[model samples]
Target: MDILDWIQNWFKSNCDGDWEHGDGIQITTLDNPGWDVEIDISKTSIASMNLDWILNENSKQDWYGVKIENQKFNAAGDSGKLIFLLGLFKEMIEKIENNTIG
Candidate 1:
């Protein structure tokens, strides 16, 4: 499935009429010509999952970083790394769902 579609489904699945009120996903552009992504996971199935920060700095225009902090999934990357950033989140969720991680 498209990453956007999968992410949308994930967000929808977490909406319990209240979780969506004060907490949700946020995707914005950074001044450094990159993408910023934040998804609140405080009340979800994977809220307690532990994932250390993952970062890759291949070049000035090819870099990304992701981490779960303060009950939220956060990520940022160069202009071309948006998909990769989201892919990281997707992979993490899949791993947890498949019982491959805690």
Candidate 2:
């Protein structure tokens, strides 16, 4: 599936309570020519979840960022980065659900 489709499916499957009807996922262009993605996880069961992107020295274009809030998480990255970030987010949510993250 395409990245956008994957993202929408992921949110629909993993989140709860009419998430698909609202601004569950938001994407915008940054002035630095990057993409900023905001994902609302307020209704999900996971708590205190966080995801961060670390850039490898060999690759600057592939990176991600996550900002945790009381009701949402904001992710930002360059092109081709959202998919990776979303995967990371899924893992993090799983960990949170399993109570493995401290």
Candidate 3:
């Protein structure tokens, strides 16, 4: 499935009425010509999960970073990395689900 579709499903799955009311996903464009994504994981199965910050910097225009913090999944990268960043979130959830990450 497409990353955005998968993410939408994931978000919908977590929406138990109240959870979606005050907490949800946020995507924005950074002033530095990058994308920012934040998805709330509070009150969900991954609430207590931890993900150390991951950064990949190949060039001024090719870079991305991902991490979990304060019950939210955070990712930021160059404009070209928007989809890649979302894919990372999908992978993170899959790895954690498969017991491949601790």
Summing lDDT over every window of 10 consecutive residues in candidate 2, give the lowest-scoring window.
49-58
> How do the residues 43-88 of candidate 2 rate in per-residue lDDT, one tens digit apiece?
7765455545444433566555666675666777777765766666
Residue pairs in clash, model 1: none
lDDT (10s digit) by residue, model 1, range 1-102: 999999989988988999899759889999989999998879866887656788889988888988887889999999988888889889888987798974
Query: Which scores greater on lDDT, model 1 or model 3?
Result: 3
Higher-scoring candidate on TM-score, 2 or 3: 3
Give the poorly placed runs of model 2, Cα more than 4 Å off: 1-6, 14-17, 47-63
Error of 3 at 101 (Å): 1.4
Give the least accurate 10-residue stretch of model 1, judged by summed lDDT.
44-53
Cα distance off (Å), candidate 1, residue 72: 0.7
lDDT digits (tens) for residues 1-102 of candidate 3: 898899899988888988898759899999889999998988766788778899999998999998887899999999998998889888878987888976
State the C-alpha lDDT per candidate: 0.87, 0.67, 0.87
Structure candidate 3, residue pairs in collision: none
